[model samples]
Every structure is written in structure tokens, then in C-alpha cells.
Target: MQQSEVTESNDQAALDAEALQQEIAAAGAEEREAVFRAAVRAQAADVLDHTTIDDDSNFLEQGITSLKALELTRNLMSLTDVEIPLVAIIEHPTPRDLAAYINEAYAAERG
Candidate 1:
């Protein structure tokens, strides 16, 4: 193959690798979000009904007190091996938002 063709092939390979890495990262993020949601739901179970813990539901409105939020943060930190801030659940205020925050923080910590 010509030098130009070789360079093009290498470039394509690099691009493919980057895409695959992105896909893997995205999958990992989704998994993390799912786990976060489940953990939050479990923690909230003592206060809220099982069905009230949907992704978009307001945790505070569902009867999650500040103490429960702190418990959740600790539980999540233990489960995920990530150092979650005590106010994270309060700051995020919803399962989806909290999951996203946790994912971002976890990624930053990993990097």
C-alpha cells in the first residue's frame, strides 16, 4: 500500500478505537446510573413507597429527610467505592440528577 493509504488506514483504526472507547464509557455510565437509582430506591424505601422512587421523582417530596439523604450518601459511597458528598442527594434532589452527578464525580476521581 502507498504511504498515504497506510496513513489513512492507521487513522481509521484510531478513529474506530476512539469510538469503541466512547461506546464502552457510555455503557458504563448507563450501568452506573441504574445502580445508583436502585440504591437510592432502596434507601428511600423506609420513607417512601416502593413505587414512588422513580427516576424523576422528587426524593424530598417523597419524605426523604436530611438524615435519610445522609444515610443514602453513605450507602452509595460504600456500595460504589466512590466518595460521595453528604449533601449530594440534597443538591441533586432527584434520582436521575444524583446518578448523573455521581457518574461525573466517579469519572473525575478515576481520571
Candidate 2:
């Protein structure tokens, strides 16, 4: 192949890589938010029947129990397709924080 043709191919390959990275990032973000929201809702439901809370709501302060925590983790595992550490759930008790943690884990696992 000609040198110029090889350089053009390399350039095309770089652009393709950049595009793939952007697409992966976008999909990861969307999946992360979706998983987090689903987990939060599941946690809330486990704690309170027919109740709704904001994304930033504090589950612990609102009486979220250990059993409910496990339930939420289970729900998140189903949604995220990633193995969530029990420690992470315990460390990040609030819904928003836990969601962010879950997002990171999901993205890392994908990477």
C-alpha cells in the first residue's frame, strides 16, 4: 500500500476509535443513571409501600433497614449486570451517592 494511503487509513482508524469512545461513554452514562434510579426506587419500595422519594432522598434517615439494603442491592445487580459490593451499599447509604458509586462500578466493569 502507498504511504499516503496508509496514513489515511490510520487517520480513519483514529477517528473511529474516538467515535467509539464517545458512544461508549454516552451509553455508560445513560445506563448508570437508569440503574441508579431503578435501584433507588426499589430501595424506597422495599422500605415503604406506595411511597416515592426524590433522587437525593436519604434512605437511612427515612428508616431504610438492613434487609431493605440487601433488597436494593439485589435489585441493582439485576438492573446493572454488574456485581455490586455489599460494602459499597453500606458505605454510600444515600440514594444519590449509592447511584454514583454504582455508576462508577458499572463503567469500570464495562471497561
Candidate 3:
């Protein structure tokens, strides 16, 4: 992608992130968890071009490089409006774990 394309994507992610934050704020607890999990799963799938993903699937094992991990982190950070380090995803290593980590981090950040 070109520099302009990257900037455009970032701009759109910011706008989408703001809207996601609002939607998340309005959701109930269970709904919020579901939202995060589903978002993580979807983002992972889209990033890796995998059609189906299990919550417990290991991203690294599925061939995720640092670049791919960074992309995933960027998208999740945009969706959740939280700064998730790429290392966190490596440590978490699964969609369920990553989603929980992001949710917890987001909660702490929000509080």
C-alpha cells in the first residue's frame, strides 16, 4: 500500500473506532464481551485470510509474522480504542485470550 493509502486507512479506522466506542458504551456487559470477541475473531480472520477461526486457534502457529501481528494489533486497537502491544497478542496467543486481554486493558484504561 502507498503512504496515502495507509493514511486513508488510518483515518477511516479512527472514524470507525469512534463509532465502535460509542456502540460499545451503549452495550450491556455480555454484549460488550461478545462484541470484543467477535471483533477480534473477525479481525484475525480478515488479516490472515482464514475463513473460519476457533477461539482457541493459535495465530503464530497459523503463520502470523511480526508484520501480520502488527496489522492485527492496529485493527484491534482501532476497534477497541485501546493500545494493545503486538507482544500482548503473542503472549495471549488465541482469540479468546487476546479479546479478554484487550477488554481488561480497555477497562483499566477507561477507568
Candidate 4:
């Protein structure tokens, strides 16, 4: 890639990081990323490679493969052991959406 492309990618990554941090904070404990947690951070880091993802980004449209999805699912399961339906992720592609779904699921499980 050209120098300009590299610069753009870096800017996008920064934006993504900021968006993610805001989302995590807004989600609170139930949906928070727990950055100190290795597994959660690793999962977030893995997905961060797809810098094109925005709050409204479509994971499927952006070529998020089944394997990557599975990996994310596995990582999440390791943390919460909640069996999130694959279709849920397919339907809610953005981090904010996924965070909302996970929070709801966690609440339902608790109550």
C-alpha cells in the first residue's frame, strides 16, 4: 500500500479504537470489554484488524468469514460460557448491536 493508504489505515484504526472504548464504557459491566481481561482484549484485538468496521458497519458485507465469526464466538464463550446463536451475530454485525444482544442475554440469564 502507498504511504497515504497506510496513514489512512492508521487513522481509521484510531477511530475504531475510540468507538470501541466508548461502546465498552457505555455498556457498563454487563457488556463492558474488560480490557484487563486477556481473552476479551484478544478477541477485540482480533476483530480490530478489520479497520473498516464502524458503529454501523456490516460484518457480512465487509467479508467477515464464518471462521472469524466462530473464533469470536469461541472467545466469548470462554469468557461467559453463553451460547450466543450464530445467526444473532449474522443479524447484528456491529459491535454496538452485538453488545446489546449480549447484555440482554446476560440479563435474561440472571433473572
Task: Find the candidate with the highest TM-score and give its number.
Answer: 3
Writing each residue's lDDT as its tens digit, candidate 2 over 1-111 gives 999999998887566546544443566586646656655666566555536766767767767678776766765565455678767666876777777777787677877
Q: After superposition, which runs of candidate 4 have C-alpha atoms over 4 Å from their true positions?
A: 1-48, 51-53
Q: Which lDDT tens digits does candidate 4 get at residues 37-81?
A: 333334544754643444455667656688777777765654554
Distance from true position, residue 12, model 3, in Å?
A: 5.8
Candidate 1 accuracy as TM-score: 0.65
lDDT of 3 by residue, 1-111 (tens): 999999998899788788888877887766777778888899999999999778989999877889999999988887888889989988999999987887778778878
Winning candidate number (lDDT): 3
Tens digit of lDDT per residue, candidate 1, span 1-111? 999999998887566546543543566767866766665666566445455577788877877777777777775665556688887877888888887887788788889
Of 3 and 4, the candidate ahead on TM-score is 3
TM-score (all chains, Cα) for each model: 0.65, 0.62, 0.81, 0.54
Each model's Cα RMSD: 15.3, 14.7, 2.6, 9.5
Clashing pairs in 1: none
- Write down the lDDT of every candidate, Cα atoms only: 0.70, 0.66, 0.86, 0.60
User: Which regions of candidate 2 are displaced past 4 Å?
Assistant: 1-31
Total colliding residue pairs, candidate 4: 0
Model 3 lDDT, residue 42, Cα? 91
Error of 4 at 3 (Å): 39
Query: Between prediction 1 and prediction 3, which has the larger lDDT?
Result: 3
Tally clashes: model 2: 0
- Backbone clashes per model, in order? 0, 0, 0, 0
